[model samples]
Target: MIQDITTSIRTTVVLWLLTALIYPLLILVIGQGIFPAQANGSLIVNDQGQVIGSTLIGQAFSSEEYFWSRPSAVDYSIGEAAAPTGLSGATNLAPSNPDLLALTEERAEILQAANIAPTADLLYSSGSGLDPHISPASAIAQIDRIAAVRNLSLDDLQTLITQNTEGRFLGIFGEPAVNTVTLNLSLDQR
Candidate 1:
């Protein structure tokens, strides 16, 4: 009985060692070689080679100088604890929900103040609250704000936006989108 128990224990130890160390190390090696950029979180850098941020996560840019992303459901909080809570959805408040009505009014007022025509996409938060792209309509809606702030012509701004718009993947999958950070950075170049 002791011999059988010892053999079982030895087999378990060997399997655990292989899985806990060898397997992970092998995956790491393969992944690093296969996708170096993605393995490093696909960080974007400016022309100065300074690290900006990852392309995968969304950031909040409220200033008119920069094109803004979708409203984040994250409450725009930082730190790990900001992991999203509740349903990943709009508050679904009724039209009669005073809070809902108030929020809509506030957003509309802000848009009007900036001379921006609000699009539907601008009013909703993405499921992940970390979406990095915005609908082309949303980008176009902010053209006035960006152009005025940069002192550039509306035509030039629209052209810049057109240049930055990315088509659907493989020309079929997913919708066309504009990366907010990339487009904003390109705007500075113009």
Candidate 2:
């Protein structure tokens, strides 16, 4: 019985080392070696080399000069106010919910006032509320406003949109998306 107990304890220790320490360390080494950018949170930097934000997460852009990201339930607070609540989730509001309806209507009105078409993406927040990508149509709808605000030509804005548009995943899964964070950074560069 003592020998059996010793064997079980040794097995547990070995398993714990393999699963908790060795496996994670191996994965970290592999990830850092092969996919450093992605493994490092896909962070974006500015011209001065200051880390701005991550392409994996969305940010709130309220200025008319820049294209807006998807509506965030948490307002894309990031490390500001949302730090306490953790990150990335939906409001889980049902379609029939009155608050959701009011919010949607308000968003639609804002788009209409701007003379921009209220596409589905513009009117509703994404499921994660942290999506950094907006639909191509949504991007296009706001081009005129951005061009007018930035004093840029419509053609140039259109070209920028085309350049920043991302292709569908694996050429089949998921729809094509435009990364708003990258797009905004590119605009700043230009």
Give the lDDT of residue 1 in candidate 1: 100
lDDT of 2 by residue, 116-145 (tens): 999998888899888899999999999999
lDDT of 2: 0.90
Which residue pairs overlap in candidate 2's backbone? none
Best by lDDT: 2
* lDDT at 143, model 2: 95
Regions of model 1 farther than 4 Å from truth = 1-19, 47-49, 75-98
Assess the local accuracy of residue 157 in candidate 2 as a C-alpha lDDT between 0 and 100.
91
Tell me how far the alpha carbon of residue 143 in candidate 1 is from the true structure, in angstroms, after superposition: 1.2
